[model samples]
Target chain A: DVKVTQSSRYLVKRTGEKVFLECVQDMDHENMFWYRQDPGLGLRLIYFSYDVKMKEKGDIPEGYSVSREKKERFSLILESASTNQTSMYLCASTTAGANTGELFFGEGSRLTVL
Target chain B: GESVGLHLPTLSVQEGDNSIINCAYSNSASDYFIWYKQESGKGPQFIIDIRSNMDKRQGQRVTVLLNKTVKHLSLQIAATQPGDSAVYFCAETGSGNTGKLIFGQGTTLQVKP
Candidate 1:
């Protein structure tokens, strides 16, 4: 079984504060993704890393950045947290092998910005 | 803009009945689709998937059907149980090799006993 773990399940931060969300996968997948899910808006991609040290901005990457220092870990950073930035953050990983391309996801971290 | 969307925002079903959720995608280039179930306060879990080449695929109790001509997708859960209650989202991937997926808004499924 593949396991994707997120460092925090819930977080609270003040406006303009810096926040970090961490995710780790044990399956050694090559692709990692960060997504923010909102009601009626769906899961919008924030950033993704296809390999170590390589990152790509997704549809909504503003005010967010990501880091991939190792194959097992991917981190998402909120440069300046704002009230509107509060959302359910999800981390996902996919193995490099198949065409099915199913992603294994971690339990999401719900961030609240006040 | 090219995107994936759900036909319904919510669906209610009685236990032991069959449930069907629908989604539509505007991107004809999408080659892969996946169905996910997300419980409250948790992340979405992969329920089943179907590729563009195949029109239908079945899992333990879930089936995914894809219609390329209409760019429509559906997930059918047979003998739906209370455990099946969740928000179901259909996601499309144009390039699986690159691991890019565009997800729909999602349909919340409510199971009644």
Candidate 2:
């Protein structure tokens, strides 16, 4: 079975603080993604990594950055957390090949920036 | 920019009843579609997917129907249960890019027992 685990399920952070969300996948997929879910916006892609040290900006990549030092781990960094950044963050992974864009996702990290 | 969208924001159905959710996409280039169900406090879960070559696909008690001409997609759940109550979204994908998906606004399904 594919296991995508998130380090923290819940967190409460103060404004202007730095936040880090960690994700690890056991399937050895090459593609990793970070998305933030809001009420009306659904899930907006923040950043994605296709390979180690390679990253691309998604639709909404502002105020966020990502790291992919290894194939199995992907981390999302919030430079200065604010109330607007408070939302549920999701991590997903997929194999690096020609196929359907089926993404296996982790449970999600719910952050509350105060 | 072209985007995927849903016809309604919420749908309510009684237990054992059938439910249908509709979505429309403005981009004709999109050839692949997927349906996702997201329970409260969880990420989206893949329910079923349909390609442009095929008109329909079924999985368990769920069915996905695609209409390329109109750029419309629908998901039908038979014998709906409380477990099926969640926000359902449709995503569109095509060749050429990084395989990233463009998702619809989403529809909330409520099952009454």
Candidate 3:
């Protein structure tokens, strides 16, 4: 089975601290994505990468950046964490070919910024 | 500004009954539509998907209907069970985009015995 794993399931960080959330997929999918899910508002895309060293901004990309140095891993970086940024983050991966747009997602990382 | 939306915020159904969740999209160019089920404290799981060319598709006990004329989508779950309770969301994908999904707000489905 395909597995997408997040580095941390639960994280707590102080305000203004830099934070990193890591995700690794064993499926070797070429497309990976980062999304932040909030109550009432559904999952909003933050950043996505199609290939190593290639990235694109999604709907809500402010205060967030992404890094993809390898094919199986994608990292979400928070330059300066704040209380408003506290939410559950999800990581997903998909194949690059013309098959369609089906995505396999990790469990998720719940972050709390104090 | 393109967006996807749900008609109802919540729905309740008794076990053994059918439940339907509705979604609408503003982008007519969207070619792919997908339905996802998200349980509390978990990520969204793919349920079923339908392409623009087809108006209906089925999988397991779930069926997805697409109305291109109105840009509306619906997911129907047969014989709803307690284990089927979750928030249902519909996502629309652009014709040329690669796996970039625009999701609706979502509808909370409560199944009662």
Candidate 4:
């Protein structure tokens, strides 16, 4: 089975602190994505990478950035955490050119900024 | 801007009864749609998917129906069980090769025994 592993299941950080959320997928998929989920806003894409060292901003990428330094590793960065940034972050991946809309996702990391 | 939205925020059904969750999309160019189930504290799992070429598709106990005329989609679950209680989200493929998906706010399904 394909597994997407998130480094942190839960994290609490103070305001203005820099935070890193790491994700590693064992399937060697060509595409990786970062999304944030909130109560009424659903899952909004923060950023996505189709290749190593390449990234694209999504609809809600204002407060986030991403890095794909390796084929299997994708990281989400919060330069300065704030209370409004508190939410569940999800990592997902899929095979290249597979536009079938099926995404394998990690368990998700719940981040709380105080 | 393209967006996907749900008609209801929550749906309640009795066990053994059928449950239907509805979604609407504004992107007419979207050819692929998917339904996902997310339990408490877990990531969204793919339940079923339907392509624009087809209006209806079925899986083990779930059926997805697409209405291109109204740009609407629906997921029907047969014999809804307690284990099926979760938040259901419908997504449409965004226009691009990156395979980005626009998701709905989601509908919480509550099953009563």
Query: Which candidate wins on DockQ?
Result: 4
Superposition error at B52 for model 2 (Å)? 0.9
Q: Whose TM-score is higher: candidate 3's or candidate 4's?
A: 4
List the candidates' TM-scores in order. 0.96, 0.96, 0.97, 0.98
Backbone clashes (count) for model 2: 0
RMSD of each: 1.3, 1.3, 1.1, 0.9
Instruction: List fnat per candidate, in order.
Output: 0.61, 0.41, 0.49, 0.76
What 10-residue stretch in candidate 2 chain A is worst by lDDT?
A: A96-105
Cα lDDT tens digits, model 1, B1-113, are 76899999999999999999999999888888999999987889988888899999999998899999999999999999999999999998764355788899999999999
Over B1-113, each residue of candidate 3 has an lDDT whose tens digit, in order, gives 77899999999999999999999999998988999999987788889999899999999999999999999999999999999999998998865666799888899999989
Candidates sorted on DockQ, descending: 4, 1, 3, 2
Tell me the deviation in Å of residue B39 in model 4.
0.9
Residue B68 shift from truth in candidate 3, angstroms: 1.0
Best first by TM-score, ranked = 4, 3, 1, 2
The Cα error of candidate 2 at residue B57, in Å, is 1.3
Tens-digit lDDT track of model 4 for B60-82: 99999999999999999999999
* Candidate number with greatest lDDT: 4
As for candidate 2, its clashing pairs are none
Query: Could you tell me how far off, in angstroms, the CA of residue B42 lies in candidate 4 after the best superposition?
Result: 0.6
Off by over 4 Å in 1: A97-100, B95-97
* Candidate 2 C-alpha lDDT tens digits along A13-93: 999999999999999899999988888877888999999999999999999999999999999999999899999999999
